[model samples]
Target chain A: MHSRTSFSVLIFILLIWEILVNLLHIPKFILPAPSLIIYTCFSQAPLLLENTLVTAVEILLGLMISLAISIPLAIVMFSFPSVDAAITPFLVISQAIPIFALAPLLVVWFGYGLLSKIIMATIVIFFPLTVSLHSGFKQVDPDYEVLFDLLDASFWKKMRFLYWPAALPSFFAGLKMAVAVATIGAVLGEWVGAQKGLGYLMIQMNARLRTDMLFAALVWLSAMGMGMWLLVGKLEKHFLFWLNDTKN
Target chain B: MLRVCDISKIYSDLAVFTNISFMVEKGSFAAFLGPSGCGKSTLFRVIAGIESSDSGHIEWEGLKLLNLKENTAMMLQKDLLLPWFDILDNVLIPIKTLKRDTKTGESEAKRLLSRFGLSGFEHYLPYQISGGMRQRAALVRTLLFDREIFLLDEPLSALDALTRQSLQKEILRIQLEFDKTVLMITHDIMEALMLADKIFLLSHLPMRIIKEIDLSNLPKPRYHLDFELAEMAENIFFTLKGELINA
Candidate 1:
């Protein structure tokens, strides 16, 4: 019900586009009307679905791999200041290099398969997750550490109990931020070289001057991004449920 | 019994405190009364073995406290209750960390909550409760560890005046019931007078004990407007005022 207003606004814009295309006699190849895009979306649904599945799988795999790697890396950095000092500069340099520029190199290294795209997405997501979580570990209330010390809490116990629970909000923030960019990274990989994916489909259709099909591919990509974001939001609500509403 | 002997802490090149010495007999209540930023909390940390002092010794029952971290529990100015945890889980932190039996810990936590008038609030998160309740939960957490010495660094200063009064009585009761040594730090002279059997008045930075007052003769269930206690409070106030001026 809340989304109805946004839907209405979208419909209003579509009506304007449909009216302008017919009134101005705009060529369909250059700028298809919303009606043509919607028609193409339905007519080529099966082909779009297949490409969307491939892209969706790549994004999910990338996010999973990023989580698996970044959490442990963050914990290691948190545990060892010398290691953090050594690794932080490399992390910053790697992050500075644009993911788009690295995509072709990744494809060359990992082959023109789903692995390359997964690595691309993982690279885009890794920094935010690791840095946010590491800072969270470092920024715990000093009083809490003092309390833990008074209890003679072991390092492992401190990590499992105090550090992990304290870092949940930051972890969720990183996850949400990662979701926003994960799809773009996956598409960039496909753009460089991929046998299947919405990015590859978009490129093929654009080369053929099939603008309607290109828009359809874009629609599916955006839908996948939206799906990921909603899923993360749900997980945040369920797992970090103790966070106060005022904080949000 | 706990003995803190000539402990000094220097951060970088600056000394925070020097030649700080005190003792709390077993089951005794002591207060380290000092101005803000006088390193009272740092002294507590040193005693708790969280931070090491530049030079000095702290011993409990003839054994050095440096290796006896498990025998001390600290209650800081802020309750510092884990906001994510409910009251029960908050109090069970030590037990879980020590790898004790959860079933026994849960029952003990339940008994403590009810004993402290915190019954029926076991499931409430820290943010869901009042400031006083949060402090009570922190006390429950500190008490659950079965430690012999407690380092309370201005534990009740953040509460409202009335809550402060009641919690002071609760603290007195806790000391008696647990038969534990308590070294509390506070700037409020009345609070120090009301709760402490002995008071160590500390001067400003590079803190040293300006005067040590013995109040063992003060009447129990100390009234708010007692003349004898008020006289001592006034005397300490002027002495502290003099110290402030000299510093």
Candidate 2:
């Protein structure tokens, strides 16, 4: 029933786009029809697929790096409050240096390759993950802390038994946000300076006034974002079934 | 045997208790009964060595217990079962924390869980079970370490009346079967009368034992003896009221 409703909505939206294009006599270069975009995707399938693969790798690598670094950093910060106090201001200031401005510097430092894109993606993804995980760690029940103390559990035991499990739901929440930003971060890095990637392809197509090709790249990017979102959602459901039932 | 000598606890400017002393036989059930915020729970924590007393000492079998291993297990009011852990794993937590060999502890854990009527629910998480089942799991966890003494901080208070009554019986049966010393803290006068061999009535805030009642002659199970136990309950209630008013 949901799929049927969504299909009908998609057709309705297409009809409206067609009507707007015809009534306003809008140039196709500015806004290509959905059908034209589809055709462009088929014709330039090979190049588009290649660039899409590159962007996907960049996003995935960035996400992996961010998870590796941020999760441990959160654990450290949680273990020692002073570490969190020291790192929080720097983490806050990092977000202020607009990605647009930092992208050029990243390319210059990392020399316009996968490293640069991955770095940008890491920067975009890590902050939310750190903050969310830290909050989750902080939110563990005080009763559990007392129980741990009574048992004389070591620091690692406390984290393994309580902190990790309590923080999982929030960690997944951060991952959802991280995945979306990771895709944008990769694209932004590619846009600044890159030989190959969806963002580069989009730039080239835009310069040549091939709006259909540009839109095709955009459609693929959106699909990638949605794909990552659905993947994480499935994982969260599989591992966190208890959380779902309890929440309801 | 455990002996507490002149133990006092003070928090900032407020004195929780002063010069409190008690002794528990090697295998017996003792209870501390009082109103809310009367320091019953605080005293329980101190006994468990989870909190420190401002002055005085605790000794077990001629060994000083200050900053020393007591081989004691505490069951809190809440189950404190990890949400991610199943019943069996929850029961095995103490074994794991104490770094006992898993092979030996696993079989022991299984035996105890089955004995406690939690055999089939071994793989079920805390949320999947009822409150009574969760408390049973908590008890099994507390027992897994083979601790000689058990500190129960109102372990069955969250259950419904019927479940609470059943658990009371279960706890008494386990205490008899294991021959372990039990120190329980509760506000329910009936509970203290039903299960405890001796009950200590405590005053509010800076709690001190004002009265001790011996219920060893009431009946095998005090809950079923309405006429006889009701009088004991009334006496305990009056004593508790007096303690509160005196404070």
Candidate 3:
């Protein structure tokens, strides 16, 4: 019921946008009409779909690699404060450096392949995942630890039962932010230098003033970002049912 | 029997407790009745080997219990129920840690919860339940470990009067039924009188055991009691009051 209202509001805005673009007689180069963009999206669907798939693969792989690295990094930092103290400042500095600024350097060093783009997305993903998960591990109620200790719990048992369950909510929080940034990172890396991606296509169309295709590519990127975000939200709801007030 | 001898703990420059010596007999219910902030919880921690005393020796059945946590199951004052886990998962924590058969362990947890009047609450998280229910779940978790001794650190302090009285009776019954030795810490004199087979009354810091009373002769359902038990409760209250006055 709530979603239907939002969907109607979106359609209403799009109809107004289409009417205004047609009535004002805006040129196709500066701002294409919604109809022109939709036509371009469908007519050139095969080419656009290929680029979208490439970008999606990069973002998804980058996110998977980030998870592989950051969860363990967060665990190590939580387990040993001295390691956290040694490494945390550098991690903060890495996030402080803008990804756009790093994109050219990454392309140059990693040689403009899928590897460079994946690295860029990973760079964007690693910080939030580590920081949020580290906070989760550190912020547990002291009472919980005392209970585990009283049980004579082994280290692995404590990690599996206590730390894992306790940190899941925060890990999901980090995952939401990380997945959102992943698309941007993939596009930015492609913008620097890539042979085939939506970012590469956008650069090509903008240079030649094929503004309809450029807008179509932007639309696809936005759709991809929203799709990933919605996926994470769904996962949160399914796994964190215990937090809800309802019986189910 | 568990013996704690010459236990003294000094925090920083100040002494929290000194020369705290006591013994809890096997299968006996012992209560440490003390004033608030008299380091009763700290003493229990020391005995459980969660913390170390500056000078002390704790032994169970003649063997030194340097790491007593291996054998002692503690129910903290706060229920300390893991917020993420359901009551069944929370109660099965000890079984999971000990690497027991989780299938049978889960069945045992269900039985205990049903016995504790928490039959429909197996899937509920700690926050979904009332304070009394959470306390009952915590007790079930502690009991599942099947430890030789139980350390109850003011377990009923958070409940209302009626709930406290009910739980007091229930715990006394559990002690007798399971033949368990329980060392309970509380500031309620009447509670000590009703449930404890023996009570050790400690004064405020630097805390020491000032009085010990035997309540084994008292009958069951001692909450509202005969004249002799009532007089004994009054005397214990005055003893604690005199310590406050001196302090």
Q: Could you say which candidate leads in TM-score?
A: 1
Better of 1 and 3 by TM-score: 1
DockQ of each: 0.72, 0.58, 0.59
* Model 1, position A69: C-alpha lDDT score: 92
Going through the candidates in order, what is the number of backbone clashes in each?
0, 1, 0
- What is the iRMSD of the candidate numbered 2? 1.8
lDDT tens digits, residues A147-225, model 1? Answer: 7877778888898789998998898888999988888899999999999999999999999999989998988888888
Runs of candidate 2 exceeding 4 Å displacement: A1-11, A245-248, B67-69, B217-219, B245-247
Per-residue CA lDDT of model 2 for B32-129, tens digit only, reads 88889878877877877778889988888888766223567888889998888888888888888889999999999999889889999999978989
DockQ of 1: 0.72
Select the stronger candidate by lDDT from 1 and 2.
1
Docking class for candidate 2:
medium
Sort by TM-score, best first: what order? 1, 2, 3
User: Against the hidden reference, what TM-scores do the models get?
Assistant: 0.96, 0.94, 0.90
Q: Which regions of candidate 1 deviate over 4 angstroms?
A: A1-9, A244-248, B64-68
- CA lDDT of each prediction against the hidden true structure: 0.88, 0.87, 0.88
Off by more than 4 A, model 3: A1-26, A34-39, A245-248, B101-111, B118-130, B225-247
